[model samples]
Target: MKHQATPYFTFNGNAGEALDYYKQIFHGEVINLQTFGEADFETPEEMDQRVMHAQFKKDALFFMVSDSFTDQNVKTGSNIALVLECESTDEIQTYYDRLKNDGNVLMELQDTFWGATYAKVKDPYGITWDLNYTKEQ
Candidate 1:
């Protein structure tokens, strides 16, 4: 199975601004940018313009960023996480189980609205990981 890790940044707001700045500096292409307003479910009017997810790639490196949910707390120093993109469901479960052994499982593995199996875990060393497995198109 393939495993790729990308840096994920959580922003209280201004994710789009940050992505734009990074793109300017890194000269990368924005692969995807989705706003909360475009989601299938309903979102507050104020949050409609907030970024739900975004990704950019520069050479061999990929970066992701998103605005935090209204109910969530996101701080600057601790706002970064490692996102693991797994190739298969088995890889997702295996990594989740192993990493969550003595760590905190913030979000249990489940199907997401974006059609992916996803989970969030804080490993024993206090590093957070977001695991995801997307089915082939």
Candidate 2:
């Protein structure tokens, strides 16, 4: 199975601005972007316009970013995470199970609105991992 890792940035806010800046610098295409207002989750009116998720792609490289929810604790240095994009469900499940040992599961593996089996975990060493497996289109 194929797997790739990409950097994920969590911003207190202004993720759209950050993504726009990166798009200019990297000259990449905005693959997908979704705001909290567009999601099924209930968000504060003030944060409804904030970016819930965004993806940028330049050639074979990909990057992602999102604005942190108001209730979430987000610090600058600790806001970065590694995202593993797996090619198969088994691949994602395997990694998730292995990494979750002695680690905290921030979000259990489940189907996401973006059409992927996804999960978030903080490894023993304190590094966060975002695991995702998107079905073949």
Candidate 3:
């Protein structure tokens, strides 16, 4: 139930470009990446290549970026998220529903072949988030 500090960026519709720009500006590498169609989340063709999730690291700093998937009115803002790496499905769903109420649900909880219960949302204040429950070995 503990949350780790993470930076989440919600782009109006230019996540890919913005991420790449940041990578270049910071001289960091995009460590992890996920796209809309690449995962369970649906994406419009125009947004397919856009970043669903991307992490850039420059030393100890982690930066995440994603395109708009909530269908809500998106705007510019400098905000961050504290990601939750939950321990179970029930926990994941409970967190998802609770956060979805006052935030933007970008991804509904789904069981992935990668063996994780995962979802993403942006709280009312424009802060993005991600939740995960990894499958046990």
Best by TM-score: 1
Better of 1 and 3 by lDDT: 1
> lDDT (CA) for every model shown?
0.89, 0.88, 0.76
Over 4 Å off, model 2: none
If scored against the real structure, what TM-score would every candidate get? 0.90, 0.87, 0.66
Clash pairs, candidate 3, are: none
Best by lDDT: 1
What tens digits encode model 3's per-residue C-alpha lDDT throughout 76-127?
A: 5643456788978888899899889999887787877667888988889766
Q: On TM-score, who's better, 1 or 2?
A: 1
Error of 3 at 25 (Å): 2.6
Considering summed lDDT, which 10 consecutive residues are worst modelled in model 1? 1-10
- Any idea what lDDT model 1 has? 0.89
